[model samples]
Target: MINGISYYPEGRKYTYFLKSEEYKQILDRLEINYENIRLYFSHSISFESKNILEIYLRKCVLDDTLDLFNFFEPILQECFEPETNQYKFEQIVDLVIIEKASNI
Candidate 1:
């Protein structure tokens, strides 16, 4: 019954919300051994507007070259683009990972 809530007061960062039971259910459904399984979660925020997104990429990656933009364009489009321009300001990612048992 693990629960977490993160608030980004300035809205500059991504906020993540997760429940342990839901993750456990997924592991159970997949028949993944959970005896010593470990889980990790992380998230980030991105802009949807191509112009703003390009600016952001440049700041973060230190490169605004066309090759870089093209490399990340498709993935960003699918993950960050919003239905409406008004709602395209930000995107929050919810990342989850399962760590293997030490014994294994």
Candidate 2:
């Protein structure tokens, strides 16, 4: 397993978390494929407020999870803005984590 976990077993093989602008950039890079699109909006509030995009890919384009992370890292680092601060962002993330886990 990679990163002390089995990504396949976790059912996260096709799931991705990305910033909206970064997501747009990637989409532009692959301009031909626009017919397949799904967007799940995450609205969160805590000491800080934030937003997130959970994108369910229709196909496997990236080679591996590491590649996915690397692809998203630059985008995330360059533009991760919350309506509030870090603490609130964490709270929202926690809520998302819990909701996602419960759904499984």
Which candidate's TM-score is highest? 1
Backbone clash count for every predicted candidate, in the order shown: 0, 1
RMSD of each: 13.2, 15.8
Pairs in steric clash, model 1: none
Tell how far residue 7 is off in model 2, in angstroms. 25
Q: How well does candidate 1 score on lDDT at residue 25?
A: 82
By lDDT, who's the top model here? 1
lDDT of 1 by residue, 1-104 (tens): 11111221222234333456677787777766554334443323444455655665555344334354565554455455354432132333334555564443
State TM-scores per candidate.
0.29, 0.21
Model 2: pairs clashing at backbone N, Cα or C within 3 Å:
48-88
